[model samples]
Target: MKFTLAKPRIFFKVSRFLFPFIIVMGVLCFGTGLYTALVTSPPDYQQGDAMRIMYIHVPASWMALCVYSLLAILSLFILVWRHPLAEILAISAAPIGALFTLLSLVTGSLWGKPMWGTYWVWDARLTSVLVLLFLYVGYWALYKAYAHPAQGIRAASLLALIGAINLPIIKGSVNWWNTLHQPASITKLSTPSIHPSMLFPLGLMTAAYGFYFLLLLILRARTEFNKRKCLVQENFS
Candidate 1:
């Protein structure tokens, strides 16, 4: 079938085919990652057992940013193309992004308490992440505030667009400010500073989180699409 963003039903069918496969992959990745992270991988020289928290914290942080980036891109699509699926996808993604953002914050705090001796700090990285969480919530609120679909999405899309500015700030915060948060390890242009043993599990967990997000995104988008279709049918009837 020809894949097109304009056709939600076609997208739904494709997602249905991919769903079970994604679930299987996600489960395998999660199981293997957990075992490797908690059992096989050596603890950090500095942090010891506390370093295991990075397994969850880093992936959640990555996913939080990734999902919000997706949201911003979808918002742009909604504004420029005005595709029906764009609206469904944007609305579907907001809560998931928020969940990831919250997870990132919580896990970061858990990890930070041991190293930084504080649970929370108002530094650049942390503060920008908090702002990202608020942007996700704000987008959802704005989308729901309007009775008209077009108006609501337009307002929400604009917020998503404006909030896109924070993405860079969140990414660059550690470099820009003297935050307690460590600098990037895996994302550096040079070879990653992370040891191979730690990087292995981290990679697996990142894949697991990614697949899980895909499964959730497709399911949520499908549900939103069906709900809208039913509403339309009812109105016509």
Candidate 2:
């Protein structure tokens, strides 16, 4: 009995301790990253002013994909283990992932106009990303639709499971077919193709975006837990 009761509380206790650390790290990374990306990093000789857009575009794109993968993993835990913490964390991730997807699409458009000469395209990389955004929205809608909240979470988990198939397609789109989007550079098996001057800020921004996601996820899950508790009390009493 004590073990069962203590399990949920244990997760939050750890989060409470980690919360301030996450915030400090997030701020430090974002501050340092933006400063380096915007002020210190040299422009790409090829794209020049337009290349700076990669600083924002790359990190957002990365986080957008990453968050969905995380959500899917959480969904797996919810389905396979019947974990309450996983469900709440999955719920917290949906909107934030959607927002990150939006940022990536918009930034990619802005960056593309200079390189691709158009704001949008049906290219495999771009289209897959659009599908990803749709998947995020689809999960959000499904998660919120049912009157029975538990039913909704289970339904959303299935969608997350199915939708994760798109992730590999998105990552491999550049290599699988001819496309305007550049092929894997920084993520290659060999040394990263990107110059160190550009790479540092990109790394920092990616770290900033990742920690920012974690901080938001922690807060949202806590708030959702409280909301569920209040809901239970109201329903019973």
Candidate 3:
């Protein structure tokens, strides 16, 4: 059996139409989530207004891990199958994942200062998440260091694979070790532990963030593909 790359024209046209639609939807959802989180939801019984930060922080944390996991999967495809789209996706996803990781850290700190009486802690979850941010930076640096595109992709993909080891660690840190971080409120087999007033906005914000990440990834991938196509045309011309 043989496989060949799909024609770029098909991807370009589909992505061109899908990207803008996702962006519009992301904006609408995020805006509505923000309004509900900030104005409509009641204050926390324990933390009061400080708990509102969860609206942004939780989603950012989710995206940070989610995007990196995607990068690792895509990297595997790039290394094994030499998929051009996978390589482009890995590259496009790095900065966005980094942004989300950074937001997670910043917002976590903001929430922590009031709740934990400290801006930072050396807990398992926090430490692992910090390491995730460093992995993002390392991947970006490796990508930029190599002169040849293939070499750069290979190096960055290796880094992504290695960094993926941390994703599970991050997800299970609270369970694997006693940590200051709270365990899953939504993922348990039983009913969600959080109140409906807060959970609704959190859920909405998470969905919005997912859409936003998809929108960005699609736009970035299409842009890079178009650039590569142009470069190839120039070389041939």
Candidate 4:
């Protein structure tokens, strides 16, 4: 089937409208979550004020994993179907995922220093997450290394697929080993084990981050598309 510009143009037009709305909602949710986390929510009995960092740390860590997982799926789409949007999405997602991973590590360390009496630990979860960050960097590097843009996308997609093998490892690390990281709290099938007050802000923050990711992804993809267009024009000129 022949590809048409009209489809992408129509989709992007709708996305342009939706993106701003999502951004507004994300900002509002983030503001509300921050307020609740800092003031309305009671401090943890064990961790005290330090527990407040969960509002930021948990969401970042979640987004780190979530975004990489998304990249992996998009990479598979690019590899199998040669979807132009898939490659664009995967490329756009990598840097944002890296940022989230970095935030997770930093905030985790800050929260750790007070509780674990050390800033870093070679625990299963933390180590696996570190590997995830490296994977993002690796994919980004591969994408930029090749002279041909198609070759770069193909190479990066392969890296993304291979790196995804670690996702299960990251998720199961706490279960597989005696790790410093705690087991799943809110994701339990039996019950959400967190308090409602804490759960509300945590959920809000997660939603905020999701919207933020989408907003950034759209922006980056549009930038990339424009760059590619300019390069094509330059080649013809």
Candidate 5:
């Protein structure tokens, strides 16, 4: 009981401390990443200037999967410990994850057109990623379907847990099945396949996106907490 009630106070304090720092870092990282990606990064030997589209697509894809994994962990916290803060966090993060998922899909299509001569294919990786996007959408829709807040959160959390099985499949789909989508380049068993010139901007963009997600998560959680706080005050009064 003490632990559960203590959570919002703790999270609010942490959010206050970290919010400004992350906002500044996110802005700087994106500034550098954008400049480096568009200008300094060399054109691909095969795909030429068209490969530049990757800077946005790759980072967005990475964040999409990562955010869902985070949702799964939060689901565990809510289910196992019944943490109110965890419930707020999961709800706060769903829309952001869904946005990234959509960005990844759209960017992937843009990259695919020139390289694959088609905007999309029924490749394993692509199909699995689409499913992941649906999972995010489903969670968002299901959570809003209930008038009772607690019941909605429980249902959505359960869906998040069940959908997590798709994460590994999305990661491995290229390797497991012959697909037009390229195998892991920046992430592999050893050193990254991409050159340092491309890698640097890619790294910056990734950091920017990660911190941007953190900023959103903290702000959203705080807002949700404050709204609930207001509700409780009204109920008691």
Candidate 6:
């Protein structure tokens, strides 16, 4: 598996075979999750129907953090191990991470309007998450700003590593501060605070998001690899 991932051609070939399975599973999870989140799961006694937004908001927030963590690791590979595929994967994933961060913010605002009586707040958690979005955008912009791809990737990867400081802040903000955002219900060391009835759909939606991110990452990495191959050929020709 390590050998396969190190070689772009091998990785691309393996991903091609796995792509259809990812699509099928993602669709099934999304279909069933929407059914349960929108139809079956009981609404919060307090927040009412608006709480359904948690299905999207919570999972998107998770993925946004997960992807950036992945980016930070890939950056280490690019900077230290100098892995060839790491750069491609890093660039491919940055935009997807940004999209997930953006989705989380938008859905959280929509949910907040009814629950908090406002669409936006400068709470610690919200502000940290917003900083996360800016980090994602900054990494992407830094990658594109250079004339050489290698230079750009190294600069962007450094940014990714530095930005990792915010992940813990985002995760711990609710705990550390008197914030509007509720403390984590599902990720506690003890048993999750959430009810099993709602947890099922949240799990399903999280799986859906994971599969979708994998699908997009593989596709984008292949495209990046091919573009680099073409450039190399042109230089040699």
- In terms of lDDT, the best-performing candidate is 6
Stretches of candidate 1 exceeding 4 Å from the true structure: 1-6
**Model 2: residue 160 alpha-carbon error in angstroms:** 0.6
In candidate 6, which residue ranges exceed 4 Å CA deviation? 1-4
Q: Rank the candidates by TM-score, best first.
A: 6, 1, 5, 2, 4, 3
lDDT of 2 by residue, 3-42 (tens): 3633567889988999899999999999999999999999
Model 3 per-residue lDDT tens digits across residues 89-166? 788999999999999999999999989999999999999999999999999999989987789989999999998999
What tens-digit string does per-residue lDDT give for candidate 1 at 69-127? Answer: 99899898889888788889888888998999999999999888878999998988999
Per-residue lDDT of model 6, residues 151-216, tens digit only: 999999999999999999999999998999999997889999888999999999999999999999
- Candidate 2: regions farther than 4 A off: 1-6
Which whole-number lDDT from 0 to 100 does residue 194 have in model 3? 93
- Give the CA lDDT, 0 to 100, for residue 204 in model 2: 97
Cα lDDT over the full model 2: 0.90
Count: clashes, candidate 4: 0
RMSD of each: 1.7, 2.0, 1.7, 1.8, 1.6, 1.5
Could you tell me the lDDT of residue 123 within candidate 6? 95
- lDDT values, one for every candidate: 0.91, 0.90, 0.90, 0.89, 0.93, 0.94
Question: Where is model 5 more than 4 Å wrong at Cα?
Answer: 1-6
Clashes (backbone N, CA, C under 3 Å), per candidate, total: 0, 0, 0, 0, 0, 0
Query: How do all models score by TM-score?
Result: 0.96, 0.95, 0.94, 0.95, 0.96, 0.97
What is the lDDT, from 0 to 100, of the residue 34 in candidate 1? 95
How big is the positional error of residue 209 in model 1, measured in Å on the Cα after superposition?
A: 0.4
